[model samples]
Target: MNGVSKVSPGVGTGLSKPVAAALSIVDCDFHPFVPLQEVIARMPARARRSVQVSSYAAVLGREHNRFLIPTGEPLRLDAVPTRGGLAGSDPAFAVADYLDRWGIAAAVMMPIQAMGVIAWAAEEVVNSYLAAMNDLFLEMWHAEDPRFKMLISVSPHDPDAAVREIERLADKPGVVGFQIPMGEIGLGSSAMFKVYAAAAHFGLPLVLHPNSVDCSLQNSPSCAGRVTRSYAEHHVLLSQPGQGAATQLVMSGALERFPTMRVVLAEFGFSWVGPMMWRMDTAWQRGGGADGLLPRPPSEYLLNQLRFTTQPYDEPGNPRDLVPILDSMQAHRTLVFSSDYPHWDTDRPDVVLRRLPVELRERVAKQTAMETFGTRLGL
Candidate 1:
């Protein structure tokens, strides 16, 4: 327990049994929701007024087209809380439905409401929303259950403000990491180096949640530099931002600059990572665009400090073909299991664990997460 911190009982009698008694799996990408009104209540009067007049839809996006069919929320119909709200809005229900059932020892709660708003919203508005979100998650969600560790949300629009936010809540119980939506700004931008440096200093890993804005707005360019016409197109191209993030972090020397800071690209698939790394290394050797920026090979930095989640795990035409791709990507060492619980296309732990080759299951389920999150997981 030297570098690691354990979660102690909070107020009520905790879960009926120890969280570790189950599978010892760590879910790296679990979503927890706060109602729009709840978030508005926490915002400053001016910010609240802005959100109230504009409404959640208008404030978040005016023209963004989302195509969630049937249920309409990209959420599992069965995940609706017993208390009657959105699927992830109830902490106790999430625990019962996803965590306890799957034997997840720890679940990292990624905030959902204010995500991807940084690029479009004003600085003060985004700052107020994110700060309020961090407080709300800490008080309403994590405080209710020690098993719910959160990656506090912070807008990347203001690095000074972001650093201050980090300092304010760095020591709060149940805060395990930082979640930054990769807005129009690339992760390697020097503006983010302060946030990166602070994360390194705090020993908190940073998780980059892909920004949906890229697929919706013309100004916010998608990986292909054009607006996606449909949700299916958006879903198919989700890994582009993750790939861009990994490439920028390596080639721009961000990873080399903040060697201690670990980054996880959540909800983005990993089958393409091996090929991306190979391409980066080849470019590094041939003196590609990275030029004087990188001191070591790009792949080395990625393998050392970067991690990717295994949700929407790739399904090839031939089921047996997965093992080779998994081996090529060093899945046992670099991949972490993320159920993406309550989301429509969630992967069940039992199913994912079963799908993984026997030798790699333990690491994908738990060990790699422990390694990635380090002391934050209290493992």
Candidate 2:
């Protein structure tokens, strides 16, 4: 599956032939980036050395911030071919290779390193690094193929800078949206509101992703005695952003203020959304909420405004039971399929789709993503 193949042109394993043929599947989440040394080489002089030092320290397990340490052996720059080296990592595996292999038409490439830069760097440093990284991505990846597009990275730590960057890149050929973390700087804060306004103004979806926020858990109670908590953090981090950010968006009336704004809670599994929505709704009814605290049911706000990605999905004993849980929680259209490509927990599309029931599989695999990205099939 190294290159394109022409299959029968329908969703192969799920749904009736007619319905499958009608669906135009687009993988809404993908990632693409150069090797770390190459990225460091491109950074400004002021930050380049520090960034490189951090990278080395990370690989050696010498960095104080556990989040900064590499989870595996660092990629040797010498091992990556100088002329063409796109196939080794997860982004290439998902966006480029998987599309050709799985019969997907296109994939929106999100940022991985940008999330780290935003999470750890100072506001000014993060903004500058983000601009450079976005340009690097546009030139290196997005411009290479129309089938691959991008979600521009933004540092919400500096709302004004983020707004300017959004305006600057909004109309660029392959840029589709903005990327921000799920729980950074408090989702309800005024700074984030500005970022949301900019996205709404440009008709771009805000992709709320997970990064170091989960990495912080290494020092928490659950992992205190353990030498490493990366795996646990990775799984649990998915729900935290959705839980905390959704509460902020509803309670602070950010959704009320920006009716047209859309949010994609990336990497976070959809299983928790139903329960969170129910809990918020129940609390609202009991006068322990944000509406009278602000003016609507938190779930209503979510139903109208939010979309979530399904990856690292729940394995509640019986795999067949997942779809019904999603439906019971009213999370059908709200769920979009994501591979979390290149990471340890990457789910195979074929496997995940096979696990889902027919109708539910169709919605998660294709329909919901099309509706969320506002792109038509065969476009």
Candidate 3:
């Protein structure tokens, strides 16, 4: 971060590399939440009173205290701007603190907390809240910065409306992809297939962020069978739903149908990815898909159609242990760096991956993300 030859990428002050030369990143999981007031103001006149902008995940499991997870404010309190805005809600502060400071070439903006409202809000009101939040992000953040890219937040509860929103934003600058909850609905259902079709038509990927509830969801994801008691417990298992989503999407022919679409699993660790792929490939080959639901092995779809972010890198103690797992998962091309910034457990990019050899470092830090995001990042 200091004493290095760093040039400005021409967004904020200048472009610079993240903590170390090897760690210059294309940050894939930067969370920018909309301020509550802005969110409410954008709501339709009739429904604004009933629609709450707070997180609906608070009520998901009556058994566990979800409150303890986020600990402080969801965003880092210190990052809040002096100009009076929420921590992640301010574009200027984000640029000064995150993008320029880290020398990140590009950052994908996933404004996800707003969608957390959909789980408990009135069913009919879900689409409006999402649409308004999408508008708010476009106006407040996307228009304010060149380095920020957009991930349109939409729920699959109303597939037609979701498609309409996707089409509307598809042509807009920086509208790179969609962010949907993995467990909100079954990934391979026909309802979700329509949404995927819209994304494929637009040539945008879907970023599967972790969240397990939705007002209109019908089927339970194979993962998340019960609520856990601690933040650490919940954090450790975030990959379960991600795994379930990948499994459902592959087994049910969603990938087969939407061949051009891509998926990025955000903040979901990679330790389980290798094992999951092996199990699915094994089952698909031996159990038989005579009906042609799965025309090829599950690994083919998983490898070709999906990309994953590397943050909260599963290994905490010994960095050497990660080498074999990364090899098994073919992480050389699949992994991208993410700094779940401004959170208590946020991984410091300089410290986390620098221990790896330079070749692997280049893949995780830059090449894989450039390949996954493509022209959307102007790569």
Q: What's the number of clashes in each of the models?
A: 0, 4, 4
As for TM-score, the candidate ahead, 1 or 3, is: 1
Cα RMSD (Å) per model? Answer: 7.5, 6.3, 5.2
Least accurate stretch of 10 residues (summed lDDT) in model 2? 217-226
Question: How much is the lDDT of residue 292 in candidate 1?
Answer: 80
Better of 1 and 2 by lDDT: 1
- How many clashing residue pairs, candidate 1? 0
- What order do candidates take by TM-score, descending? 1, 3, 2
lDDT of 2 by residue, 30-146 (tens): 766655555556667776645533443321112344542244532332223223453224333333245655556556777666656533445666676778778877777766666
Against the true structure, whose lDDT is highest?
A: 1
What is the total number of backbone clashes in candidate 2? 4
Model 3 ranges with Cα > 4 A deviation: 1-24, 53-67, 121-124, 214-225, 289-292
Q: How much is the lDDT of residue 106 in candidate 2?
A: 58
- Per-residue CA lDDT of model 1 for 1-379, tens digit only, reads 6869756433122324433335678999888887666777888898777653322342254334433334455787777786687778888888776777668889998765656464455788878888887888888888878888888777767888889899889888888889876765678889889998888888889987654544533245555746666667777888887888888888889999999889988977898899999999888888745458888888889998989998978877776788888888888888998988878888877777778899988898899889888877877
Q: Give all candidates' CA lDDT scores.
A: 0.77, 0.64, 0.71
Model 1 whole-model lDDT (C-alpha atoms): 0.77
- By lDDT: ranked, best first: 1, 3, 2
* Angstrom error at residue 132, model 1: 0.8
